[model samples]
Target: MLARVVEANERWERLAAQLREENAALRAENEWLRERDVRREAELERVSAELAVLQRLVFGRSSERVRPSSPAGEDDDGQDDQSGQGDGPGRRQPQKASPRGPGGRAGRRDYSHLPRVEVIWDFAGGGYCCPECSSPFEAFDDHAFEQVDWRVTVRVVVHRRRRYRRRCACAGPRTVTAPGPPKAVGKGRFSNGFIAMLLVERYVAGRSQNSLIAGLARQGAQISSSTLAGTCAAAGALLAPLEEAIVARNRDSWHLHADETSWHVFTPDDGDGPARWWLWVFIGADTTCFVMDPTRAGAVLARHAGIDTTTGQLRPAEDGGPRRLVISSDFYTVYASAGRKTDGLTNLYCWAHIRRYFVRAGDANPTQLAYWTRDWLDRIKALYAAHDELTDAWNASVAPAPGRAAVEAAARLDDAYTAWDTALEAIEVARQAQMKSPGLQQPAKKALATLDREWDGLAAHRDYPMISLDNNASERALRRPVVTRKNAYGSRTDAAARLAATIWTVTATAEQAGLNVLTYLTAYLDACGRNDGKPLTGPDLQRFLPWNASAADLHTWAQPPETG
Candidate 1:
């Protein structure tokens, strides 16, 4: 009986061991399944977020504005109401409307600068007499009122050059004829003024070539598309020197805003399809330049901004000093790559771009993450407000050159800087705390990651007060070209693409200098015509640069050209 009992115990022990091994294997399998389920859930969330973003982009508004929610115990006006008392019983207080002057309408504009024409009225019989009484009336002070009128006409100008005959015929031709008027194109039909109008209409006004042709036809001028294209080409060739000068000035600026957009080029196929091109803009305080390139790589930035490709550092200035350039741009890797390679170049990433990430996250899943997105957006808004304060203080400090006022202004500026630093610190603390929270969702987490990655660049503006908080200036400079691209579907050839860039550079730079674009183009083309239908060089070209132009020239360009 003892042997049997020991055998039974051994059998039971073996059975228990088998059961333990099976349970361990089952646990491992179950854990793997659970992990797979978690991964699937995360993937689903990401896909949903992406779909939401795509939908918003396709159907939602383009504006990135987000209205902040009111805090507890505060009203919409941002006033505290801790008592929880109502304005009245069962009746809300009415909001006051904004005041508008003179029957809520804008005042009449002054047209004193326009030319005036008089029209006198008389009786039917050419006598100042009343019809009913048939009696003559003495003329009194005339009553008058003004009415603006517009008329567009097309006419041919006939240059009447006089011819004279030499009686002595002394070592010269027997007859001499006066020189004809200058022509923008050699033996071309159009005048310099006509070419200027065509340029402004197509480039400045963003009108297509076909539209220009039709408009001119309506004005009694029959012109073909080829003719207009040739005119633009001729004008572009003449203005190439000026464009180069502008580019040189743009590269010399210490601070600049850079941006780029895609452009389609229908180049001839060389065993390959059409090539994709890019349009780049670099805007300074008083200059704007556009460049067309076949590639959208760092080389374009390097070439235009004078950076050494190998070292990624700016070349030495003309005075042999280190060249320092601060570029404001989006968080493109090329800019960051260049920034990483050198100390002389600094990249200021746009805060507006960082804010856009959170904006998109909030829009993607408004029902679940609206509050979270708004909190982050509010933090960014606080940064902007603080920056505005810093800007105002800095401007005030610089306005008064050297005086007691400047001393006081400098103190205020220092205070503003301190406040700005405090604000930045608060944001950093909040970002860190939120990153550690367990309830964070995938969208918000991704947004935070971007913010963290670009934090140093976003905050770099504090070191240089002259730089702006965003790259809106460069973006604004690109609007005109974008519109033209949409209308014309980009240039047809490489040469045409380059010509577009040159003309756009001149027009945009001229506009930045507060010059009338039409007037500026007309004046420049006339100078080109006088230069024997060739591009201006040396001092002549420098005189045409908007920044180098004299005050008298600027005043003249500001006025509207007379129409006969």
Candidate 2:
């Protein structure tokens, strides 16, 4: 009896220890769940903030913002409320009611009012043409006819240049080339028209390449993927010099926008890895330029901003230097201290970015953070409108300088600065309140504080007119790669990625300049092949753009004007 009791006590003690261990694990899991919930809530808030800013920027109103449940409906501008039915494959606008007839009823127009066409019937063939003449009658020729309309798809011929070669009687063979072919695409596989069509289908038309090819095939043009790629690649190589020239111009420009995004590239590993890609866009009130480089570091900025790495700052040209650059970018530490010579780089922050944090966290703490963010966004909206109005007034009246504009842009800038100060104060107070509140968790507090700390960058544009009020240009440029990422999944090799970047650089630049991408690309390729002549330059290439000139003009511009 004593031995059994001792055994029973040992078993009971072991059971008790196992139960304690299980309870401890359950408690740890519960804590982890709470932490995860906090983090998720914070992420949701950030996304909300971003959407609100995007809403205002794209739609020009904050109150009209709607959450997109599916990615299918959202457009490039983030407007998804546009219905696809009537605008797409559904009921069309009702046509106006037909005019009443003579008796107050609808009737066709009188043929008597129109001139009569001549009709001839020859009684030369056996068929009865003219009953008056019983002899054999020929086919009836009718000049009088009814107009008919129908839709038919046909393969339109873009000119194909034939190279003529002649063998001299005594000497060697001579070849006459009719200024080669258009530069936009390669000669052997694709036509200039097709390449232009491709760009239109992909970018402006927003259709996938597969869809484009299938659509073309239905229209009787069977183009393979390899052929399309080759044509694009060749044209891209040709247009490379133009991009360089644009970059050269940026060296003398007063403002530039810089941004980067993740680009996935396939490797010989288990899964795809992340590759950082940089996109830099510069606009000088007139022209726009875009570049896609692989590097993410400040070195990419150094290359485009003309920074001398040794001195760790920007280097002006030999003659003189640009006065200032109103740079708009995310608060990356690298650019904050990017060594600018003499006058420090004028750093204008994006208010759109600053307002996003609070909007994103609204659901978690809707009362203070959300309300405060909305108020700050309103002030930023006023600032944006003021600048736009100033620009429009200057444009309308042809003002010589920013200070002399119809809107007094400089004064507006000062006003904007004051607004930023007020918004900043409000944001800080809300942030502190969130941090102190027990109900508000770390994620919501941290995200708000981040925007609060970056106030200088968030409100940078108010200092100068030359600086943009936001990083919209850079973000707009990033959208191209993002779309490409979804379609191609990613690139296969480093070279492939480089090739894509090269193509994207010129293609995006062409779009920005309102050039017909196909025409420019084809002409560029033709010019590239004629390397024996003067190498094509950017300004020269600009004249051949499709938007600026007709296809014939581009063709003529691709070659020297016969050197007469």
Candidate 3:
């Protein structure tokens, strides 16, 4: 409490000093007669507008969520994916302040541990007396209310490891005592729990290093910000094997969702290159891997997915066998190039992204758009509806074991695919008829060009129903890191950026596999400590991998998700 108060006072003093300087400058501005009042006002307005834009760029909401004129159906059970949020305590706290109203407000809480504090209200002489009559009065009944008694307390724990020698033991009277607990950072005073908490608070909770320093100082730790940063970097380096495991696991998957977001780092891949770093997210069915690079080039995707960008070739999986891979991504040029460069690779473009362009086009030129945009939306909707029906049929018909019904479901899917083709053909015919003259406005025309460009990739999913219609899975995986990026304004150096990629890979992959990040980190760090900071490999490491991990092992190391 004292630390917070002092810090707040210091900030106020600094602001006051700034304001004082500004006031002095204003007082000395009598030379303003040099400019016309109207022009000066106009200049002030322009500066104010620019400042507002800057403020928005720096501090506005970071959600780039596209809400079309007609809302798209949810890809999940209507549950929006949150960066660090989960079902209970020890979960990731939401990075942003909750907006107003019922959705923002949480349900009734059960923080039952009320600290006892009392304030007694009584009349003169500590008695219930009538003040005007100066006479004692009997209290009829007691009224009570409850309120939170919140305060801050800070302390440091001193771990005292006692050493003792066996005084009369036959085993040479060797010195022995209980082992001291492991630390995430070697030779660090902080415990593993403290380090884990700091990590969660920083990355998952989206708190900056300076914010962490202030918070610890409030707890009387008085630690420097550099110490926390160094600890985090050390922890990332220590648990790098787990990150590699995630990437290796991704390599083994047949289908993956790939996406990337802008990041900033001082010493990027090329020192002379712009710090326009890209954070790539490749999420397999069971694993999520985050990698940072200096370019948005297809080469990063190629390198990580174990493919040769020059030729459409995949190197082999861990089993030394080539994979028949399918990649789903947004309409980025790099994704297309990467897909084309790989053999037997099916590229599925996001349908939602396709729809978003048309939606924007319709918004820009609503009158002309009504001629064919509505037709396009209807056809798209019909296609999705058929897909949903087929998906349901497949789930209902396909049995646990190979059977006649499984064959029947495959036939039914094939029939649905044919039917979808027929529907698309009808739309194409209508489009060809209108292509002669008086076609679409520039907005709609541009949108049609995109559809034409991506049709092959968008329809590639017809051969594979297992792929999603959208690249939402990968986008959702990047949300937490994106929020942290917004908060920290990105990393300071290449090493830090690389460290973040490694750490976030393990954490996000564990989250995808429904594993508790804290427990996973602790176990991983303990393993590294036991191995003298060596990376895990072979059978010893395979068991720790999420895909190979046993149910009991996951439960022991991290909480398994609740199932219906």
Question: Which candidate number has the best TM-score?
Answer: 1
TM-score for model 2?
A: 0.58
Q: Judge candidate 1 at residue 278 and give its lDDT.
A: 94
Instruction: Please give the lDDT score for candidate 2.
Output: 0.52
Error of 2 at 303 (Å): 1.8
Worst 10 residues of 2 by lDDT: 83-92
**Relative to the true structure, how large is the alpha-carbon lDDT of every model?**
0.75, 0.52, 0.66
Index of the highest-lDDT prediction:
1
Q: TM-score, each model?
A: 0.77, 0.58, 0.68
C-alpha RMSD between model 2 and the true structure: 16.1
Clash counts for all predictions: 0, 27, 3
Ranking by lDDT: 1, 3, 2
Q: Compared with the true structure, what per-residue lDDT tens digits does model 2 show for residues 1-564? A: 999999999999999999999999999999999999999987886676566556545553343254212223232234433312112212123333333436442333222222322323222232332223323233323222221101133233223223333432333324332333333432343434445455545544444455555665565444555555665556556656666655566566667776677665555134354455544555444345555556677777777677777876556656775345556777776667672333446666666565455444443344444444455456556656666654444344444354466456556555655655565455556556666778654436656567667766654544454455677777777676666665555555565566566566666655665555655554555555455323366556665443444666645544421210
Model 1 scores worst on lDDT over the 10 consecutive residues at 81-90
**Cα-based lDDT at residue 558, candidate 3:** 78
Report each candidate's C-alpha RMSD, comma-separated, in the order given: 16.2, 16.1, 24.8
Local accuracy of candidate 1 as per-residue lDDT tens digits, 176-277: 344445566765666677777778878887766766656655654555566578878988988888998999899899888999998877762332435679
